[model samples]
Target: SALNLQLMSLTLFDVFGAALGVFVVLTVCKFVEEELSNINMPEMKGKEGRFQYTITDVKITELNLTHADLQFIPEVGLLFDVQNSSITLSFHRRILYWFFYDTGNINASAEGVNINTILNLIRDDDGRLKINNITCDARIDKMKAQFSGTLGRVYDFLASFLTSGMRFLLNQRICPALNHAALVHVNSMLETIPVRTEVDQYIGIDYSLIDDPVVTSRSLDMNFRGMFFDLSHQNDTLVNYAVDPVIREYDRMVYLALSEFFFDSGMFSYFTAGIFQMDIVNEKMPKDLEMLLRTTYFGAIMMLNPALVEAPLSLQLAVNSPPKTSIKTSGATVVMTAIVKVMVLPPGQPPVQLSSMTMVYTHIHTSFFYFFRILLDFFDSNIFKIFSNQSALESLALIPLQAPLKTMLQMSVVPLINNWTKRGVQIPLADGMDFIEEVVEYHNGFIVIGANLHFSKGLREMISVMPPPHMAVYVEPTEALPYDSDITD
Candidate 1:
């Protein structure tokens, strides 16, 4: 019951995606098998000329389902709906005959008997394939006969019997066997598909919801989650990246969509993990700043605030909006804006909060090399000041520290920002597949992306060369009776 509930909650898209691949290979096979098996007629006998008839086997030499149309029902998920599908199949029947007066015995065979039909495919309540209907106006195109000995006029009866018996068989057996086989085959296939894949040491894809697929006239969509973990580091805070939104589609076989949220714990683990402190004794002034400080009173006054050699730095990252993702010809891109706050604790004084600064980070990742590159397009720090409360020192310095202070502040913090941007985050977009075409950012938080997979020519050729499903008869041998003569002796 628990397992059933779990499957019920899963998205239908994952099952459909995997099933589609298997369906392509089995479509023709199933079609032809149904066509041949439909010719199941009860045995017929005529005392006038002793004869025995039976279909030894049925084989489908040709089949085609590529032109079939697709249909979807959102209520039932992505059920397989096909119409006007056709097939060309052939089979064989064996026969035995004798003269009216037992003058001679005959053994014969019929080969190359052809059949054609149109098929309709559907799904049952259990999510298995069901062949609802089949329509065909076909007959045995050609039949080869191998005869040992035949009585006169018996040939006419044999031909008439073959025709009538085949027609009667088609009326009785084809639909039922076809429906049964389809259901069993599809259910078996569903068990083989994998619901999740580990991309690497740090990330994995969760396709558990893929069974609840969404389809429309445009394309198919499925929901999945990305599992991200940092094995080496332990943090008390956890980030929640689960966001639901209505994702829009643009083009391609865009099947998979995901939404990710950001958390402080995740950001801290990614960007900062060590003590960051700056003090007067430990601070190394820039060459130009140091030169200016020695030459002017303004630099002399700056020294009074004291270097942050012992001050402990506190870092906070605040996201203004959820990151937006989209696909480009090169690879996937994430555009986001964040405010970085830095606080310093001065010796014998309360902690001082620096000015709040905002930065827009645009990340471009390439599918080919799997490299992450971030571009800082905008930085807003209009009210940024290093020592805003030190007005007395500023008056004594004889010059305003706004311009020089801004330069010093930029020099101090920009490198740390750059280092975090360069080496902090990485997403392997092309982990297992050949390439990802594009990613779409939704109005909500969901992200839609299309994946491109490559199949080898050899594999395609092997599937084409495979023989269609066939029905064969195997009779068990009867056991010999015990010798009664030995017991009498």
Candidate 2:
């Protein structure tokens, strides 16, 4: 869709080097360890005059990635340096002679191994991240081969040759194992980022990337199609009329900016899905409110029929249009326009509409945005304005209904909408990571959210292998950014 192209100017995430460093320490290291756990090594055979032996069923069963460091290579890519790792393998060794032969299992291990690799990052055609190239160098400091059989002593005599040849073979496999992990497993993990996912029954959200990530000395900027769509009508998109949100600071782990369209589209989806409507009748309506409704519509009920006077009263509220949001440096203001229809339902008959009035709901968030709220006359002037009849006399008669109707909406309708929104929409993030200490600031036509990140697990939970001494990570304390700085009304 052209939605990404249209909203390409808006940034979705401004990830700093600090956040990326945590991700590498928490996720990539453990993942690579798991991916390189098992590697089958080719068989080796050697003959020298009367002494001959063949190694079969060779496999590296244990791998421990002890240390990993990531560095940015300016315009090139990321350099991955791994140190002090170890690999253990099991194999069947057979000794053959002119007339005598012996067979036994042997365990071999190599420690103090180091792997250096460069990972080239790129954006694929599908707008997903890809590692286009990987160049790896491996080094093994020491290798040990333990042999056991009836002729264990004889095998020990040739340990140097056995360990040397096997070390070379093991060195050959390191790059391929790392290559598979980066290109296949690591890239597969990136696919979990949501492109089009249903947030609830009525609406869906798109976190699809708009363009390739921009890498700089301090941060990585990514643009996305941050739009919500109606489930029943997926093709509809609210055009982004608001100014693009700007990222001014690079102090936090990440900064997320949302223009007004980011929120308007969510309201549009709910409106289009018919979720912005409610019907209150019978026990749901308060006794005093019902008394007011009956008293106000007494003349209309009498005109319809004397029997209709005892009919049950119903208050129906429906949003007339999509809600609009305004953002300023202080905070945000959300305004919604809805129409309320007063009606009555009689036994074995269709409900009859008695009267309808348009109501605008506005909530002031802060003093700075409160001033601009007055500037939008089209939204502010209609606050509680009511229209009941064509004649001036009929309009005067409906004056009693005005205050009560608005009060009922403020009490019931607003909370009903809030309860639905409280369920919270699912964000597009890798499992176990969540945002914390979020601070919102309003700008003209847009909003920004600056927040740090946290993981559900500590260092032990983050990795299956033993904890590394270099990084003993614990939960980060909540640290909010400066107020009056971010996104969404």
What shift in Å separates residue 125 of candidate 1 from its native position after superposition? 16
- Please give each candidate's TM-score: 0.43, 0.73
For candidate 1, what is the lDDT? 0.38
Worst 10 residues of 2 by lDDT: 480-489
Score candidate 2 by TM-score against the native.
0.73
Can you give the lDDT of residue 106 in candidate 2? 85
Error of 2 at 84 (Å): 5.2
Name the candidate that leads on TM-score.
Answer: 2
What are the lDDT figures for the candidates, one per model? 0.38, 0.67
In model 2, the runs with Cα more than 4 Å from the true position are: 5-26, 57-64, 73-78, 84-92, 96-112, 121-127, 130-133, 141-157, 248-255, 279-284, 296-312, 343-355, 365-403, 415-419, 431-489
1-489: candidate 1 lDDT, tens digit per residue: 111121111121232234444543354445444444344334333322456555434443444443332234443323333333333434343445542332232233323333334344443343323344444443333332322344435455554444434333442344445444343333333323333444333322222442334444444444333332233443222444344534444343333443333222223333233312233222444556545443465334334566643355443445555444544345445554555444555778886654344545555543312222112211223433333233554433434444664565456644654343333323322222233344433333333444333323222233334343234222222322211222110
The Cα RMSD of model 2 versus the native structure comes to 12.6
